[model samples]
Target chain A: MSTAAIAALTAILLVGIASTVIGIVGHRARRTSDFLVASRNVGAGANAGAISGEYLSAASFLGIAGLVLSDGVDALWYPVGFTAGYLSLLLFVAAPLRRSGAYTVPDFAEVRLRSRGLRLVCTAFVLVIGWLYLLPQLQGAGLTVATVTGLPAWTGELGAGIVIVLSVMFGGMRSATFVQAFQYWLKLTAVTLPVIVALVYFLGSGHTYDRPAPPSFPERTTVDVHTGVTLQAGQDVTFTAAGRIDGRDVAPTEPQTWTAGSRHVVGEGTDLTFPAGSAVPVVAGGPVADDEWLLPLSGADPHQLLGIYSLIIATFLGTMGLPHVLVRFYTNPDGRAARRSAVYVLAMIGVFYLLVTLLGALSRFYTPQLLVGGQTDAAVLLLPTAVLGSGTAGAVLGGIVAAGAWAAFLSTSSGLVVSLAGVLSTDVLRGKRLSNFRFATVLAGAAPVALALGVTQLDFTETVALAFAVAASTFCPLLVLGVWWRGLTAKGAIAGVLAGGILAAGAVGVSLAGIAGTGVLGVLLYRPAIVSVPVAFATMIVVSVLTARERPTDVDAVMLRLHAPERLGLSRDAVSGRDRAELDEPAPDERAAGPA
Target chain B: MSTIEERRADTGTVYERVQAGPEFADLRRRLRRFVFPMSAAFLVWYLAYVLLASYAPEFMATKVAGNINVGIVVGLLQFVSTFAITTVYVRFANRHIDPAAERIRQQIEGPAR
Candidate 1:
């Protein structure tokens, strides 16, 4: 069969498997309880695996690989931050969150604050983060499909979106748990198998591939800029004079080369064609100063500081607020189970990161030709082919990379769609009604698809990073404060969620309108997580302190419930689905022990 | 003070009436205060990791892992330490926490009398 046929077959088979599992689970799930938290019966190992599967997504698996490949050594932090974010989840929020007896974050807000308004605000934040996260999963699917079959990107996105909607809308968390758990292993196999095969292929080639040597620095002359518009004085901006790589002038091909003085031409009349693989050393002639390390952070030029910050904030905090990630914890039998799952997730993620770094380093050395378009995202896909040469060996390797991409999109999208479906039923539909749940799932799938199609042209990693920054800004603070601080009030949560969510949303909205890079602060604040997260945490603390009187009177009791282990049985009834109404009235002896 | 003591006597009678051992009742008081804050501390430490990663990348960029960098090492440690912490928690639960909780549960339920 052709590659398209094979991929289509695989897609159908996987979706069929997911649908069957959901069908079995969904039939028995008649109540709101089943749809929200899977009746709280999942075991530790399975939950951990599912969480890992969900959390890995396109971002963790492919995005990290892509990042490490392009950004040299600094990119390793992406996976580190992604994994470590869970430690924060485990240490502070897991047990208390479980004990709260709330299905979603909004439920916790409403119940804790006794305010519908607070619930609505939180619901809005969840929707924004969920949508932002989902967009990349779709984009990933599109890219993967395009890579594999030479088909349109929309074909893969639409195919994956349709599958997710059908399965999740009908199935809910009970279904999502099984599929996500299975996908983790599939993803691992998909990624690791190709690398192993490629390694073998590399060996068979007699270990004699011509590895491109690093550019020699001593012979190359660079031009130093004595006068330029200084963002920070004393920080030298050295432009490279016209130079040759393989006997061709490399400077005209890379305007950002040490060749251009303080300025490069932009807009219609400017020269555009540049040699794709040419590397320009940005800070080559200077003693690089403070914050000079983050030159790509500037939105004014992709070469500025804010650009780097944007990428960092998105990747670092995005791990925390991912829907699929949070939902993975729900599959754990208890809070402790959730915490342990996160632990295992970290280990698994750490190992893959090692390989990612190697792949990145190899790409930098061997495949300078591929970097010509600055299509760093395509490095991992192209690496295998580049190594194997354009033969069946290359096709097989490319196919494997393509499969990995598909897994990233499918796994992450399913997790996100499931979470969105649940939120839609709970928040948008105002109850966990089954029909509403189905509608929410469709909306979840369709909205992202529409957004993906509308913005078919975008930098995949950059767009996804923006989503992460927004997520970190919004939910990270909310989940952290909600679980740990007893003084956290409904108003504070609402304020923080709004402050962070709105700021990030506003940044995204403005960027979409092409208002980015207009000014320095505009560039700095373009990736709002740097500003928004602090604002969020501060908003929560300030509002919470001011509204201390309205803080839950049973905060102490709730804290006890959250802290007490499942072994303690204080909150066992909560996890075991023994509703408060069914809980036997405590005898005097037991009553003396606690109000929790 | 007299009225409070009287109220306690009545409540104490109810405990006996329900057949809950005094030990079960006492466990609730002891365990709540101990576990609540302790767990909360861990959660705070975990959140700090998120805050540091999200808000403090400059600090993370410092080298630690031989081009792996400080941010990468610390972030990766979050995953490694999570499993370590969970293992510690599970062991802690099984050895001391779970057994105490189970004992209380049994005592309160009292084998259906």
Candidate 2:
């Protein structure tokens, strides 16, 4: 077996063992509270780590570097937007959300709006967003394993899906939290160590980026195409080939010349050699030339400005509505703790993203071959091997990064599955038994895995961004209005959610169906948040004002519960002095009366 | 609707008492004061950055320091400003919001003893 395969297998095994160990350690989570929100006793630091772990999905770990390598300086917006999302959460949503004491977004919706119908609608959107987010993670796992092990993609997806399902089923929120927190540190160390070594090597090698030109192969390099790809050659080049070119089988005995300024189809298992100082070919639809790559909004597309603005809007407003992320805030002991944890999350995610952006920039200088192979997502996984070659150091660093990627997939997918299962078991199934939760876990994980196995065309970052846009359109309006504005009647909420959810989901569907043509309309469909979010908000406000009589009479009480700090003692289950004493001691009768 | 009203009535006295109190009003004012202005400022700043990066690429690409352009510097400052805002808000909450909220809690709970 190749070193890459061995390294990748070791990484997967280590992740599996780590998760199992954590599940065993946190095996005592029997109550529904433990299952759903870890008994709401988590500290700020640990919760922050877990939140960071789950938040940095495969998109952040692999896709960001890939985007930076492929798309240029404009891609920096992704990391910036992602980390800045927590700032919005910290400022607006964190404390109030925790103080509201809702276990899920749907629960919050039901409580704040006092409507079961709106709760159900919120639940459906939660599932949609969770599954949408899960798709890229599963697909990214497939891509990572394929890049590292040369194995077929489906194996990795299935492996990640099964592991996440088992772990979530075994210990629910408690185990998932512990495992995710540990994975955060593991991912940090993995990326940090390899980049440090690479940086040292780079400084010693004394390579400079002083030239004003696009990237070229520093030495003769041969790239094996594991899947068929069409290459857009820039200049005439003759290279040795050992596989099918343009649907004709080519023997390993002879060399072939690829003409410049035309597209050529290279079949699977082809090894193409490019001599030193040759410019790398573009991957058909991917970015071109360093000038366009280095400059923001200059990438041969007219809709670039619209795309950037929409992306910013979606990511900026969307994070508070992510089901997995919102549920993590519930694990905090109180509103103050929740706010503190958000602070820590901002710090941790900020430092990690800085390192990730650096890795993306370095990948350009080190692994431009990924850009040519149309596998820029492998830029992170391939950097160690590219710089250090296949020696002991390379294999070890490669194994570490591979493990980090697995942890990314595992933590994120587990968080999503846990949130999905909680919503299903609690709301849809109306069965809170552990058995029902486990069953929901299986169901929640199955659809995404099946979809991931069949679909392979979407970019990882773009898929995740679509989920964000939908969430921004749907729940951002709901939460902002429900929390701050007393005029948000139930009828208005339903109209808003339906309008936003349908429009955004339809845009995604159109884009997915490949029916969107390249122009303003196409760009709007591709990035719908700019238009759809305002439409949802406006529809909600207008409908609410028209149906003002339908507003809940208890809006004052619900708003008090949400905005009042924990120190306010205004929570629904507030105990009298005697009851507080009984609760503290937990006598037999008190134990019996405790939450089920 | 009847069931909802019954549930509301169960907690009605406490909600009414809290809402009637001055401390609760003070707490609301303090929180709104901190969040409203902060949120507006941050949104405006973020939108400006996005618009500039999209439409004013030449400005964003101008060199700020050696090997660092204005865009990269501004991007890094985004992180810095986030941390700064978080620190300031945490301090603000601890000093102003928490004490007022604590007073209201004591009043609603009718004395810790």
Candidate 3:
């Protein structure tokens, strides 16, 4: 096996063993006296770390860099929206959500609207969003492993899936908020070290960025195309080729000419050695030159403006609706702490994303071959060895990057599974047993594992944005109106959620099914948040107004609970509302004695 | 609906009374007054950045410094504004919102705090 592969394997194994051990230990403590107390002890800084850990998924770690490498400066919007989304969350929902005393998104729906039916619908939506979000993380894992190990993607995917399942099953998610917190620091150290080192190297290497042109190989470099790709050649280039080029075999010693503006198809496993200072041949549909890359809205599609708006709306508003995100707020001691936690989250993740963007930029000079191969997602993983060569130091650094990527996958996937299983065990199965929770966990991780293994690999960040669109469409309206507007009825919320969920999820369904057409129709269909968000808001407001009589008479009390200070003693959490395992599922007999 | 009403009667009129009073109104008003205007302000700021990014590509590509452009600066500022707003909001919450809420809670829920 290759040194890069060994380092990556060791990294994955280390993260797996550590997390599972932590999970087992955390579960044992929670089964006894320590769980309930641990919930309230989560400090703002540490909780923020945990939140950031779970929040920075495969998309933030790998996808942003890849998109930036491929699409140019316009891609920075993804990370910006991602970080800025927290600002809205902090302003509008942070304190109120914690004050509302609802742990999960579904729990909040039931708490605010006082509707079981709405809760059930929300349960379904949570599962949908969770699954949609989980798919990309799993796919990202497969991509990372396949890029490193050069093994079939299924092997890496299955390995990551097993680790995630095992960790969550051992009860790592609910009790050990600190484990996720540790993951954040681990990820930070992992990615940060390589990036800082690489940045220094790039600066000292005396490379200049003044020329507005396609990135050329800095040295005599040989790149193997693992998959068939159409290259958009910028200038006439002569390359020694082995394997099929334009459907004919070129011997290793023979030099082949690729004309400028000509689309050249290089078949799988073709090795092309390009001499230094030659203009790079980018993959078809990628930005070919630095000038086109540096400029925003220079995307190939005519409707890119609308697409950016839709993307902004999805990510900016979507943070509040994430299931795993809100569950962490319950761990905060009070509403104030929750708000504080959010601020810290913004700070922590903001720094992390800035670093991530830097990595994306640095990948330009170090690993531009990824641009040709159209697997820019592997840019971070391969950058170390690409710069440092395939020696001991490079392998060790590569291992760190690979481990960080694994942590991203493991933390986010496990968090999703925990929340999904939280909904499933409590709402779906109607059971209080730990076994039921374990079964729910299995179902949660297993379904996405199957889907991730089965589906075609997509641009990781874009797929994640689609999940955000679904969230923004459905739950953004629900949380916003339910907190701010008194007229928000259960039936109205149900209508809005259904309308938004169906429309946004329908769009995801269309795109995932590969029916996405180009231009206006396609961009709108792909990132439908701008349309779906407004439609959901209007539907809820109109329905709420029309059915004013159906409004719950106890709106004042619920509002008081939601908006009032935790110090006021009016905003006590219902036993059924929290994700606390001691108070979780099949309510304790004494609390269950209370009449509806 | 009747079942919910029945449960409300059992809990009695404390919450409704609290919700109706001026203290609670003032508290809610204070929060809404801060968050609404602030949310709008930052969103507009963010929107300006996004719009300039999309419509004014030539402008966005203008280099402000060595290897830095208008687009990159504005994007980084989005980060700065977010952190600044967070700090300012926390200060506002601590000074303006918390003490009043604490006073009201002490008045109603006793001096346990």
| Count of backbone collisions in candidate 2 | 0
Q: Write the per-residue lDDT of candidate 2 for residues A413-469, one digit (tens) a residue.
A: 899999999889878897735688889999999989988876544668888988999
Cα lDDT of candidate 3 equals 0.81
CAPRI category for model 3: acceptable
CA deviation > 4 Å runs, candidate 3: A26-38, A219-230, A240-256, A262-273, A576-596, B1-11, B111-113
Q: Considering only chain A, what is the TM-score of each predicted structure?
A: 0.76, 0.91, 0.92
Poorest 10 consecutive residues of model 2 chain A by lDDT? A573-582
- Regions of model 2 farther than 4 Å from truth: A222-272, A284-287, A513-516, A567-569, A572-596, B1-14, B20-22, B64-66
User: How large is the C-alpha RMSD of every model relative to the true structure?
Assistant: 9.4, 4.5, 4.4
Query: What tens-digit string does per-residue lDDT give for candidate 2 at B1-113?
Result: 24334545576877877877777788878888988898788778777777887769889878765446777777778778878888889889988987777776666555555
User: Which candidate leads the pack in DockQ?
Assistant: 3
Candidate 1 global TM-score: 0.72
Give one digit per residue, the lDDT tens place, for model 3 in A207-307: 65545678888788888887788888877888898889889988988888888778889999998888987778988766777767766665566677788
Candidate 2 TM-score for chain A: 0.91
Per-candidate clash tally = 22, 0, 0
